[model samples]
Structures are given as C-alpha cells and as structure tokens.
Target: MTDVAFDAHDGIGAGGTADVRRRMRDELRQWAILAVGSLAIAGVFAFMLAVSRLPGIERVLPWPTGFFAKGLVIHVVFSLVVWFLTTFALLASIATLNATEEGPRLASLGATGAHLVALAFPFLLAPAFFNDSVASLNNYVPVIVHRSYYLGLLLFGLGIALPAVRLLANVGARRLQDFGHLALAMSAGAVIYIIALTCIALALSLSWGSEPGRTFHEHLFWGGGHVLQFLYALLMLTGWFVLLRSSLGETSFDADVFRLAIVLLAAFTLPAVFFYKVFEPFSPLQTEAFRRLQFVVALPSLIIAVGGLSGVLAARRRGPLPWHDPGFLALVLSPIVFGAGGIMGLMITGSDTRTPAHYHGTIAGVNLALMGLFLVHCLPALGRSVPPSRTVRAQILLFGFGQLVACLGLFWAGGYGAPRKMPAGAAHLVDGAVIGMYLHGVGALFAVIGGVLFVSTVARALLRQQPAAPGINSAAGSLTQIKGRRGGR
Candidate 1:
C-alpha cells in the first residue's frame, strides 16, 4: 500500500482536491508558524535558564534576585504549554478540513486565535524583567504572579480554547466517517484539552482563598496539569500513527483496536471533574487523585506503542529499514526515550532532579514525534516538501540522543542527591553529582544545537514562496511520491 492509498482508506484524503488541499494547508500555515515560533522564543528562555544555572556565571552576569525562577516560569509556559497546544490546534484544524459547512468558519476562527496568541505571547516575557513580578514555578502551566502576566496567560489559553470549542462542536458522525481514526484521535485530544481547562477553572473556583507562596500556585495547576498530560499522550499517539503510516505504508495494528484505545483514553478523562467536587481542591486526596489519573495514560500508550513497534518489526522483515528517513528515525527513537522516562518515573524517590529527568524523557519523546510529523506528513501536506537531507536527519538524532543523555545525567545526579531546579553553583555538588552535571551540560548543548537546526529548517520552509510540486497539492497525493522514492530504495 502507498500513502495515497492508505490516506484514502483512512478518510483523510477521501475527497480532497488540489484546491481544497491548498486551502487546508493555508489554514494550517498560521498554527504551524505559531508552533515553530513558540519554540524559537522558548529557546531564548532556555538559554537564559542554562546560563543562570552555570556554576559561576550568575555572579559574572548580575541578574535580579528572582531572575532564574522567573525565567524558568516563562520557559515552561512557552516551551511546554504554548508550543504543544498550538500544534494541537494545527492537528485539530487538519482533522476538520473535510467539514464543508463548518470548515470555513472554524478555519477563520482558528487563524484569528493564532494571531491573538502571537500578540499576547510577549506579555508573558515582559514580567521577567520587572522586579515586582513574582514567579510561581507551578507544575504544568507556571505563572508569574502579576496582572500583566496573568492577562497574557489568559489570552493565550483563550486563543487556543476558542478554536478547540469550535472544533469539538463541529465533530459528528459524518465528520468521523469522512476523516476516520486520525480525526477521532485528534477529537479525543481536544476533548481532553477542554477537560484540562475545566479542571483548572474548577480548581480556581474551589480554592479562592488567601493562601500565599508556591503552595497555592502548585495546588492551582496540579489537577489541570495532570489532566493535560493525557492530552499530550493522545497527540503523541496520533503522531505515532502518522509516522508509521507514512513510513511503512500501513499500520500494524487493527483499526478497531486503535479506535477502542483512543476512546478509552478520552472516556477516562470524563470523571476527572468529580475529583474537585469530591475532595477539597488543596487537599492531599485531591492532588493524589489527579496524580493517579495520569496512570490511565499508561495502558493506551503501551498499546499504541507496542503496535507501532510491531509495525516497524514487520517492515524490517520485508526489507531493510529506512534509517535515512527522518520519520523512520524518530519513530524508532521516540519510544525508547519515552519508555526510559517511564522507568525513571518509577525510580523517583524525592524532589530531586529525577523528576525533571523523567519528564524530560517523556516530553522529548513527544517532541520527537511532533518533529517527525512536521518534517514528513505536515510539510508535504502543506505543499512544502522536505527532502531527506543529512542536516534534517542529524537534527532528529542529535535531539533524541542529546535528550536521552541529558535525562540520564540528571537521573545519575539525582541518585547522588542533587536537588531539582537549583543552579549548579548553588547545589554545592561534589564527586558523582559534579560528574553527572558535566554530562547533563554537554547533552544539553547538543540538544540546543539540534533545536536550532529544526527551527531554522522549518522557518525557511514556511517562509519561502514557491509553486506547489506535482502531486503535492492534493492531500491524498502529499506524501505518496515522497514516500515512494524514499521507501522504495
């Protein structure tokens, strides 16, 4: 089977024409730009974070007292929250392209929302420079405790949420029939995203007290943050499907089984709202309930990942693997990194660097999947082809291995009692901890280089004006030719 044939069977390209596909690509362009741009901006903050953590760099470059904490808060919001959600919006937009009646309205609303997010993003950074702004380094969506920062966060959430609502409202049996399992997966993710937002609202309403310090903000974001993990998990699964299909020409798993897993993942989130009602928002019970809710993601993730691995193995049986293909490389590495993270999560014994190590592994897995999707499925679908190149391949491998090394380094340091979120100079490390930090620093450097390569490549592709290549403008034909050339070899 070819990608074109698989897409037709899967309903993504069932009735899409060149003109229709072009419009769809145009609609997705803004969200893609927003997603990439968020990473670029996040990289800036990430660099600051690395600098702040340097052993003696802080004294040399005198920043404000709370600058490290504030920078971290901004980094988490942009790198994790904004980047992930904007990409989700883009995926949601792709799923709804077949909605003839509702498509146009939704596209307009989504584009407008993307613009709103871009406009509001700067506000998130503005507070980092101000002395008065307090950094609430909460898990999930961290915030700076200032009105300006709050406004920016609110607008950013609203921008994504508005289109999400429209996307959910437009979903129906017809759309499902036309769009197939991919649409179902995206819709499931959107539903979970909305549920996450609702969890945040419920937490705020239930705990409107005069609590002070990090405790309040931590409890505020705890429930919502845990729920948001399901959203990211769902999206990662979706990426796996796209990557497997585009690379292998077919998925190894049964369609019915995949749909069942997705439904289960989404259905489990429905009961999360009651956690707020049943227990006090700030109580340990409520926090534990939300924490346990994350376990639900495990089974489904394993099911899909195992199925994906099965597909890769089956492909290997037929012929040599497409190591040269960036999608194939990412598909192979994503699970290894994520599974390592899951293992590390089980090893976490205290509030040490192990927790960051665990999350870094898992989030890197998600990042790898999305990057592969963009390089293969997304760019081609948008009539912007990304031919397999050494640089692109290196970017994928460098980011994957760099993150893995970084996570392992963190895990090693945490095992030696290195504290989380502390600058190296402040950690007062010796012996093993120092060695681990050294490895962590080196891995992070390589990862940053990889990230820069990705941003530059994608930005150049998005900005360059060129006519659509033959067979590229039609959604069904987008990856057919490219996959044929690469996979046939």
Candidate 2:
C-alpha cells in the first residue's frame, strides 16, 4: 500500500497496470480536446485584456468600451476559474480511470460537456453584459449571476463534483496499492475542491437575504475561494512532481513525505470549513480566518517544492541532464516562476499592482508545469509525436519570459503606487507608470503567443495522427514502447 511499494511494482508493461493505462490514456485524449478548446478561449480573452491596455488599440476594438469590465470578468471566470478547474478535474478523472477499469465513462463525458457549457457561456452570453446584465467581479469566480451564468455554473459544479465522487468511491473500493498514492492524493484534493464548492453554494444561499450588493457575493466566494487556493496549490505541486518524474526519470522526494504532505493539506481544511460555518457568514473575522488559513495551507507546497528541487540537484550530480527534452526544461523553469509569484505575494500592502502580479506569476507557473506534463506524457501516451525539441523548448522559454516580464512590470508599477486593475488609460499618465503598463501589455502579448503555441502544438500532435492504432489499450503503451526502445530508465 505505500507509495514506494506501488512504484516498485508499477510498470507500463505490467499486465494489470496496462489496462489502467489504456483507459487513462483514452480519457486523457478526450479531456485534452476539451482542454484545448477551453484554453483557446482563455488565451483570446487574455490577449484582448492585454491589448486593451495599449494606446490606439481601444479605438479599434470591436466591442463597446464598457465591455472592458465585462471582458475582464469573462476572462477571469473562464481563464482563471473554469480552465484550471476543468484541467484538474480531468486529471482526477484519469486517476480514477486508472484505479478502476470500469470507470464512470458516461459521467466523465457529462462532466466534459458541462465544462464546455461553462466555457461557451462567455462567448454565447457576452452580449448579455451589454444589455443591463451584471458583472460581479468576485475574487475567484467572477461572472454575471444571470440564468445563463447560473446554469453554466451549476453544470460546471456538477461536472467537477461527479468525477470526484466516482474517483473517491473507487479509491475506497480498491486496495491501497491498487491505486497509486499519487493518484489517491490527487483524488483527495479533488474532494476538497468539491467540498469548497459546496461551502460557496451554502454561503451564497444563506447570504442572499442577509447581505446586499457585492458583500453577498463576496461572502459567498470568500471562504470557498480561499480553500480553492489550497486545491490549486496541491494540484500544482502534483503537476510539479509528475513533471519531475517524467523528465528526470525519477523523483528525489520521499514518497511517504509527499503523501503525508497531501494528507496534511486535506486535514487542514476541516478547521477551515468549521470556521466558516461557526463564524458569522460575512464577518471580518471570517475573512481574516480564511486569509490566514490560505497562508497555512500553502506551507506544504513549499516543503514539497524544496524536496523536489533537492531531488533534481541530486540527480544532476549523478549525470548530465537531458536538456534537450522540453519536459525537462519546463520542470526546471516552472518553480522559478512560481517562486517569483510567491515573493511578489509577500510584497502586498493593501492592494497595488502587485496583487495581479503575484497571481499571474503563480498561475502561469502552474500552467507551464501542466503543459510540460502534456507534452512529455500525454502526447506520447495518446500516440501523438511530440513536436521538435527545439520548438517545444522555444515555447516554454517564451512563456516563462513573457510571464517574468509581466510580473516584473507589475511589481515595478506597484512600487510606484499604481493601482491594480485601473482603467486602460489610467496607467498612461505618469512616465514611470507608462513604462510599467507597457511592459505588462507587451509581455502579456507574448504570453498569449506562448499559450497559442501550446494549443497549436497539441492540435498538431493530435491532428497529425489517427486515434492510435488498434490493440493499443492505452496511451501509456505508446510512451512505454518508446522509452523502452530508447532504453531510458
């Protein structure tokens, strides 16, 4: 049952494990299709918001000027909330499929559809924003609370929850070693996220009458949003570990320590949930409680990250690294970006430009890690050839550079007291502020390019090939064969 034991016996060629790999591979391809579409929308909106900051661009914009806020809200909702959650949800579903041969195929498909529905809403109902519809810029889940938004949200919530439930149920049903510890840990994180969603729903329902205006929605989002950070941190940490394993051929961290870290992350939430329910819904005490809890919840990720880094260093001492592998490049770069985000976070002093800088940095790092995993593992498993090593390396570097410049600009602007999320024209006033804003706008433009590269890479890989030749039960098989022939450890 321990992770070490599972790893020792686990091999792609192992007969029992092969079945799981096939199912997981099939599910991942399906999820990848959904992910690509979601990511494209997210990229476009991200590019738009960046372009909006530049002079001469707003006049040529297709939508009305008021649409800026609406567009920002849409971008935040789909890019930040939907896209990330959908990707993590798919990861958990794949883990479940690995655990159980007879996975919840129908429900998994439904979850994908629901996520697509949520993704589609911003485009489909964008006009609603112009027609007297509200755009509540809640911290985490910003969107209009109209019927269409509500319906999409409801389905999205269900989409996230159903797969989690199936995964957790399977985890309980199976033996410990049967489902690898990493998979189980991932599943546990999914459960925590679903519970956080439930808490948000409860808060929204209870506060509608008691609290008015943004307070109601803020109260609704506060605790759940706080908890979701832990979820994101956990998933990002998992992605880091996965990337390390894929790129380095082995991870340096102790399996027991990693699993325990995951357990502690899940355990810490018990108090968070209790604190939310026991305290008044909209009290400052509640807000402070969740804020402090986020700080506490984030500790494990740091520990794991350090452990992973140590492992990488030790591996490098053994031999020269496979620098040509894009996955390897990402594994090295992502943590640096994430750490920059953390440092930017520590510089917060009553909400300046640093706030967005912190988040975008961290989120970009997470995306990079996940993208690396896809290129190294998912594409190969799905019987798709990874792009040229040079191309993949270029994409990774472009993303990292873009994000670094963007965050640097924001931090520089924040130091000058430039307010965060100001209108596009506001930052253009002071010369120093203009430089900062221009840096962000230009960097974001490149970040969008990097994102586009990812989408294009995935599309090319998939489109170039058929749905894997028959007799290949899982995508893992293809990867196993390739690695085997290469004689890699």
TM-score (all chains, Cα) for each model = 0.90, 0.86
lDDT of 1 at 473: 37
Q: Weakest 10 consecutive residues, lDDT, candidate 1? A: 480-489
lDDT of 2: 0.67
Clashing pairs in 2: 22-473, 22-474, 381-475
Local accuracy of candidate 2 as per-residue lDDT tens digits, 258-326:
666787888787676677578886688878888888777567787788888888888889998867777
lDDT of 1 by residue, 13-118 (tens): 2344655545555667888899999899889888887777777887798876698899888878878888899998887776665333323444467767777888
Q: What TM value does model 1 have?
A: 0.90
Error of 1 at 127 (Å): 0.9
Best by lDDT: 1
